[model samples]
Target: MSAAFDLEAIRRDFPALDQQVHGRDLVYLDNAATTQKPRAVIDAVRNFYERDCSNVHRGVHALSQRATVAYESSRTTIRKHIGAHDSREIVFTRSTTEAINLVAASFLRPRLQPGDEILISEMEHHSNIVPWQLLRESTGAVLRIIPISDEGNIDLDAYQGLLGPKTRLVGIVHVSNALGTVNPIKEMIAMAHEKDIPVLVDGAQAISHLDVDVVDLDCDFYAFSAHKVYGPSGIGALYGKRKHLLEMPPFQGGGDMILSVRFEETIFNEPPHRFEAGTPNIEGALGMATALEYIDGVGLEAIRKHEERLMKEASLRLPEVPGLRLIGQARQRAGAISFVLNGIHPHDVGTILDQEGVAVRAGHHCAQPVMQRYGLSATVRASFGLYNREEDIDALIRGLESVREVFA
Candidate 1:
């Protein structure tokens, strides 16, 4: 542990980590899927329900005003968290999938011509891949994939070669969810910029673990989910360049997104408001902001150091297990670690670990291309979080022993 890393105190802030399952203390290693919410986030959600349960942007009542302030204030917090140029660039969405889809539908779909290209990496989640595929089917646009090395890192030289005049945009994952491979996004974005191509970063897996500055990175767009960052599910945000957001049409047409409506014609509102249609997730916005604040209080640098230690320990120890082969041996990694035990299916490994109170993810993790790259269908993934400790890794190893015994 790093100096002054009060692991116990950090663990206590998350109530879910204190509980047990199958009569053993829960060692949650499924953080890459969704992190357990901290008390601050939970409390913020509860307080909203108890006090300010009103729709924002429509109501004239006190509750509505309070909800509106809190909701929009959360947007400001998100804007600051990502270092976006303006709050107007941050549009709330259902999740990262919706955020990416928004860009696909509003920004790119109409502009892309037949035979135009959309480039993404082999390690992208389905959310990033499917939208481009759908765009291809609809508009006759071509979708190209940048292959990854055997170690799961995106091939920069290959990516540069693939960038051409017809390439409309590049969508890259900031971090690999299944492999924990952290892509050098800043460099990649710069390369795309040289070709005058916009880049969209799938930041769902990177936001909680890394220090993200959209301004510094100069990415055209960034998509991420609150659930992955210790906040509520069903809410996420997209940070688009102000220029792009202004040029793009609204993804959805509904109440707040319109400035005026008549039977004959309708006029739309400005950027963020235009993108966000209907009643927004008021409580969710508040909760996500609180989660961001909690992370700030803990200090991202400290959290980074702590998780680095855990990753190093897991790297050294997982290889010790019999017939186990770690996957995604990238040049750089963070968050999740995946491996397969010989003669054991990943599902079986995950199931047996669950019996010993170790919660992990199994299967393709929504990255079938990554699975295809390795010529495998699935692998077991143990992901980490701020609340996790080295003891959790020890417990995970011990649980694997149980899995081995069961199969034997």
Candidate 2:
């Protein structure tokens, strides 16, 4: 691999990466679940709590004003990061799950009829699937799924066919968490737009791996989590077009969400704040902005190149192990690889890998539909990050060999 980036220097930024696990250096490959925090992000969170600890947008005190400024500035950072037209279009939520549920409840539910349909893909995480299912039950609407090929790419022909008069909205994942298939979202958005349908992109996995411009993609709504990109947990952002935010109802009712409260009628706040109810994750938002700044300093293009090389190397070497079968070989993949041994359970594989200090996710990955499609109960998934090195892949390969010998 080309040394375009100083990998050692980059790894030093993440304090967690310097530790030892089970008598070996920690090879953290569970980045799809959540990335390790960098010192910059940690300091940002600590600084906020120590110096600017106050509730936002309400108090007239100096601390509150400073808190409000920092909190809103993070919103501006996120807005520019995603190329969103206005910061008012960005609504803070607890996580990507909450963000998707917010849109399903606030935007889709109010307009949905008994027979309306929500189109999603077969490869979606449960966060994307369950919310729409809840909406379906409430409104008696139907849920339609776009099938994926054996290679893990979405069947675009099937997706186009599924869209019809009853299709109220389309929700799709920008990248498959389990498979690492980067869906052609820009084209999918265009297809949906032709029929006057709005599309929501689940970007939890894509935001860190790719340069996501909500404006360039022309997606109506995009949701992603902070922790997926080396930020703190319990915070995420939902980006909606200004018009949609203006039209959508508040997902929850609370102190800051309302302008005036009356028993008979309540006047709600404007777009962004209307959706953000109660006390927000003030420190988390600041940390997420700091994380974004760190990513910017590293440069996303360099990160992408580095990770792609890692993925390619791992892909070629992993299947060479006895009894190992690589799953989901999409032509365009990113950041993750899922595999299963011929006679070994994924949990067992994960157990053995962990003993060797290689952490990987081994389960349905909250995407049961994907498991059902592939006719497997689970798979061992090792997802990469920018801080990961070539040695991590080598360690994983050696660990898998040990697993094979034990099973043999």
Candidate 3:
């Protein structure tokens, strides 16, 4: 552990990490799915419901005023966290999936012409892939995939070659969920920009594990989920460049996304608010901001170093397990690692590990194209979070041994 990273103290911040499961101390390694929330975030959510519960932007009462202030304050915090220029660039959505969908429907759909291209990678989560597919089906556009290498690295040469005149937008994942590949998105974004193409990054897996600066990357849009970063679920944010957000139309129609409405024509609101249609997740935003503050309090650089160390340890030890085959040999990896055990179904591996109080994900991890590339239906994924420890990796290895014994 780094000198600044006090593992024991950090673990204590997450109340969920203190419990036992299946008669053993729980070892949670499924951070790619969602992370365990710290106490500060939980209290933020609870406090909102307990005291500051009220509708925002529509009421003048004290509770509503307080709620509204805290809610919008979160948007500012998120903007700062990602190094976005303005809070108006931050639009809240249900999750990363919805954020992408909003971009597809409101931003790209208007500009897309028949036979125009939307570029993405083979390692994308379904959230990144399906929206573009839906756009293609509806608009007669073409969806192009940037192939990944055998080692799970995106082929940059291929990516550069595909940025042709017909390409409308580039949607990429900063950190792959299944493979743990940390893509060179900054370079990729620059390549797309050379051709005057805008790029949208699926940052769901990157927000907690990496230092994301939207301005530094110059990406047109970035989307991430709160739950994956130890915040509440059902709330996420989309960071769009101010120009794009100003140009895009409203995604949904309801309470907050408009300035005025008439039966003939409804006048829409400005960017961010224009895309955010409905009452919004009031407490969720507060909790999400609190979660980001918690990360800041702990120091993101130290957390990064700690996770990298744990990942290196896991890399060294996991291959020692009998019949284990580590997946995705990308030179740069983040909080996720995947592998398969010979002749054993990944679901079975997950079940056996669960019995030993080891939690892991066993599936294609919403990246079916990645599995298809490797000729696999599924693989066992062990992901890390800021709260994870060296002992967790040991427990996972011991649990894999038990799996081997049972199968034998």
Top lDDT prediction, candidate number: 3
C-alpha TM-scores of all predictions: 0.98, 0.98, 0.99
In model 3, state the lDDT of residue 177.
96
Q: Write the per-residue lDDT of candidate 1 for residues 16-72, one digit (tens) a residue.
A: 988889999999999999999989999999999999999999889999999999999
lDDT of 1 at 173: 97
Model 3 per-residue lDDT tens digits across residues 1-408: 234777898899999998899999999999999999999999999999999999999898999999999999999999999999899999999999999999999999999999999999999999999999999999999999999999999999999889999999999999999999999999999999999999999999999999899999999999999999999999999999998889888899897999998999889999888888889999999999999988988888988999999999999999999889999989899999999999999999999999999999999999998899999999999999999999999999999999999999
| Residue 113 C-alpha lDDT in model 1 | 95
Could you tell me how far off, in angstroms, the CA of residue 251 lies in candidate 1 after the best superposition?
0.4
Overall local distance difference test of candidate 3: 0.94
Candidate 2 error regions (>4 Å): 1-4
Model 1 quality (TM-score): 0.98
Candidate 2 lDDT, 206-272, residue by residue in tens: 9899989999999999999999999999999999999999999899989899999989999999989
Residue 201 CA error for candidate 3 (Å)?
0.3
Model 3 misplacement above 4 A: 1-3
Q: List candidate 1 stretches off by more than 4 Å.
A: 1-4
Candidate rank order under lDDT: 3, 2, 1
